[model samples]
Structures are given as structure tokens and as C-alpha cells.
Target: MSDLVSIPADAPTQGMEPNGWIVVGVPTNFFATASAHARSGPLLGAAAEVRFTPVGFRWDYGDGTSRTSASGGASWAALNLPEFSETSTSHVFEQPGTVSIGLVASYAAEYRFAGGEWRAVQGLVLVPTTPIIAIADRADTVLVAESCSINPSGPGC
Candidate 1:
């Protein structure tokens, strides 16, 4: 996915100056790609191109865990994949649950350039629920009784 990035203000501006205001801009256009897979199964890929400066970025795979990466050249890794980078991580859900994956990118930092210092841009990703099921069977008397209490409105019931 490609998004247009914009810089943020360090603090709220109260009044307009005589000549309005002066704003600083930073270099945009960054590209990042992420791929996830079961250690032995299929792989899923996602990519994003930064259109502006971002201070921080995080990824939540909706498996009860999350990962984060910096927008700059900094790198991060996961335990399952030792040789991996920050933009990607491998995860496995312990049980069946609705997984809503997403990303949070924000302008939480300031940088100093040749001219001066300026705040960065930010973005986020919102993923819907993804069901993951693990099969198991257990016998419970309450459940059995509830199942046996049929409404008798249909043949199966």
C-alpha cells in the first residue's frame, strides 16, 4: 500500500503571525514490505511505501502479540526468525480467536537537519478479524444437557 505522508507540528500553534506562519518540510518517499508465514506453511506478504516522514511504526498481527519497527534504517527481529528484520515477524496463535491485525505509525520524534529540527509524520493500519481454529474435544455434562434440551421446532432438534 502507498500513502501520502505529512509532517506534524511540535506544539499547537495559538495565534497566526503577521505573515501567517513558517513551516518546514522533510524528505518523503520510503518503501517497506512485510511477509509472514508459518514456520512450515504458506507465506503472507504486505508492503507499504512511505510518502512522508514517520517517527515510529508498529504492527499487530492480532494473535495476542505485536511487533514494532522504526521508519528509519533501524532494524528489529523476532525470536522465531533469527535472521529476520524489523518490518516483519512470525506469529502463531495459541488458540482459536478473532485476529484483527493492524499497524500504527506516528510522528513521535523530531529530527535535526541542516536547517533546523522538525517533527515527523505518522500512519496506522487497521485489519479485520481473522479466525484461527484449533480442534479439540471435551465432554461436559452441562453442555450435553444443554444440547439435549431441544426446542422441538425441527426434526434435528
Candidate 2:
């Protein structure tokens, strides 16, 4: 097969732990959500069906760092790990600022014409998800008389 597949696949979405405002020097988890999809189009004057299957995930931490993983990282609770624990797709920010986190899903494709047997495509389809912007900040530990939820204006609350 020629190393080409003109069909485009849907991009995956990115999910982050802590949602926003991550702590500096702490590991922040990231994950990707992707699924296989089928699309029908005209190929060489015949009806063709193309199916895309997600095979890889790539993460761009937007801090001059990136990583590729076979499986999308799961939540801390899902993984049974404590918060701030290191994960396969986690990234730690060294400074306090805003950064964009990005995810790209790579898909392998197969095609069939007129309900015939499926044929594997030679190359993968790369699709990028919308970047998620997050703020990185520092957190401090302070013992107080009451919890922050109880005392909104309390020190360090």
C-alpha cells in the first residue's frame, strides 16, 4: 500500500487534572479521549467506507516539553494514586504562569469499497485537539483555626 490515506479523522479532546490553576513543582495529569469512527465517501467512482482507530496519543505541555504515550493517562482516583503524584502523561511546571496544554491523536485507518474486504492504510492520520489553557501557581501550607470553606476571608483562605 502507498503511504497515504486522504481520508481525515476526527481529532481527540484533552482533559487535565486540577482543571485550572496547577501548583508549581507538582505533577499535573493529562489524558486524551478518542474513539474509532467510520465515514463513507466516494473513492474512484465507488462507494468507500473508511474507519479510523486511535492508536497513539501525543501531549504538548506548552512549556517546551512534550510526550507520547500508548495509552491516555487516567485520573488520580481512577489510577488509585494520591493527588500530585506522577503519571505517564503528567507534566510539572517550574514557574508560575499560564500555559496551553495540547493533545494529538494518531489513528490507523482501513478502507473497503462496495462492501468488500477492508484494506489497511499505510500511514496514520494525525489530528490535534483544541488546546486547553491552564494557570500554574504556587500553593502554601498554613495551619488555621478553621477550614477555608468555613472562613472565606480567613488568612490563606
Candidate 3:
């Protein structure tokens, strides 16, 4: 019966607060965008439609750390929070390195056949989003004679 309906494996899109690079020991905000969609096909030898809706999200920070959230999370701008502010989907990198961060979206489905009432599909569909390659670096405070741009060759510059 489950084989009659098809759900899309299309992955979600992810965004980072800093746009690409993150800093160690600081919250790096993450967000995902997904939408409910329906597909039409044949089920039980009758015309049918299946709808998929996102219900949960799993975040894999790729540093041996992972978390699951009921919400996919929103951008800092969307949430009206300052950049680098802690969010439900934010994570703190403990060290400096290049890491692959990823998200897996879980979807609940409903199907209707021959214009009948919608029925639960009985299982969740898991789809992985495109991985984000982020470079985590440590921020250092240095006392220099002049700014790096102006000096170009001074102490820390």
C-alpha cells in the first residue's frame, strides 16, 4: 500500500548567520527552508494525491555533535535577533577547522485516493539537506601599532 505513493527526496536548503565562516566558542546560527508539497499519482489502482509536510529537523554539526528540533529554525533577521545570537538551531564550534554541517528534515505525509478523505501514511520521510562547508576560526585580540589595512606590515598586521 505504501508503494503506491511517492514522496520527493528533494533536500532542504540551509543558511548560516555569518554567511560561510564561523568563529569558535560563539553561537553560529543555522536555518532551514522547506515547504509542504503534493504529488499526484496512482494508488490502489485509483488516482491519488500525496502531501508531505515537514515535521522535524536534525542538525549534524559534523564535529561529533548533533541535535534534533521540532522546528527547522529561522534566520536571525527573521527572528529579530542580533547576528551571532544564540538560537534554537545554533551551535558552538569548540575548535578551529573546516567542518561539514548538515540538516535532515523529517516529513509526515497524508494521502487521498479518488477524491476520498486524506489518510495518514504511517511513517515519516527523512530527507537530508545539502551540506554546508564552514570554516571555523578562533578570534584573537592583538595590540598593534596601527590597523592592518593602514599599516599593512606593522606588528600584528
Best by lDDT: 3
Q: Over the stretch 1-157, how does candidate 3's per-residue lDDT look in tens digits?
A: 3663354545678898788898888899988987888888766676778888889899999899999998889998899775568899999999999999989999888888777899998879888877999999998764656787987654333
Relative to the true structure, how large is the alpha-carbon lDDT of every model? Answer: 0.29, 0.81, 0.82
Off by over 4 Å in 2: 1-7, 142-157
Instruction: State the weakest 10-residue window (summed lDDT) of model 3.
Output: 1-10
Tens digit of per-residue lDDT, candidate 2, span 39-142? 88765566788888999998888889899998877887888775667898898899989998888898888889888998988878788888999999888874
Please state the error at residue 52 of candidate 1 in Å.
4.1
| Model 2 Cα shift for residue 87 (angstroms) | 1.1
lDDT of 1 by residue, 1-157 (tens): 1222232222211111111111111111112333221111111222222222344445454446665555322222212211211222323334443334455544332233333444343433222222222222221221223232563322123
Candidate no. 3 TM-score: 0.82
TM-score of 2: 0.82
Worst 10 residues of 1 by lDDT: 12-21
Off by over 4 Å in 1: 1-52, 71-88, 108-157
Instruction: Write down the TM-score for model 1.
Output: 0.27
Candidate 3 wrongly placed segments (more than 4 Å): 1-5, 44-46, 141-157
Clashing pairs in 2: none
